[model samples]
Target: MAADDIAGLIREAIPDAVVEITDLAGDGDHYAAKVISESFRGLSRVRQHQAVYAALGGRMGGVLHALQLTTAVPT
Candidate 1:
């Protein structure tokens, strides 16, 4: 999948999110994403990852695989 597509999906789930995607393997499948949003402020790391996975709408294990996600609230 494209980086823009990943960012778009995240943005759709978290409207106020700031997403940055990096193709770790340059193979379109492996990626590292940084998502910053107020929604993650009080949530745990697991919860934050869950939120992002939910945003992907089941694409995590399907079309998209091997994602390294980092989430944080804007300072």
Candidate 2:
């Protein structure tokens, strides 16, 4: 799970998304992602996170270990 791959997945799912992924532990397994998109405008915080998770296509607990996620509607 490279940072670019994570970003790509998010972008694929949310075409207008701006995704930033950080390699937290300097390891491919741990990450922190900030996803911004207009698509999240009316969604709840939990739903916003879920959307991002869904974009990963079930890679969350498998190939990717831990992700600290932050999502927002673009300002």
- The runs of at least 3 residues in candidate 2 whose Cα sits more than 4 Å from the true structure, single-residue gaps closed, are none
User: Lowest summed-lDDT stretch of 10 residues in model 2?
Assistant: 18-27
Q: Tell me how many residue pairs clash in candidate 2.
A: 0
Indicate the TM-score of model 2: 0.97
Tens-digit lDDT track of model 1 for 1-75:
899999999999999999999999999999999999999999999999999999999998778988999999999
What RMSD does each model have against the real structure? 0.6, 0.6
Q: Model 1, 30: alpha-carbon shift in Å?
A: 0.3
Score candidate 1 by lDDT: 0.95
- The alpha-carbon root-mean-square deviation between model 1 and the true structure, to one decimal in Å, is 0.6
Number of the top TM-score candidate: 2
- Return the clash pairs for model 2, or none: none
Global lDDT of each candidate: 0.95, 0.94
Candidate 1 regions off by >4 Å? none
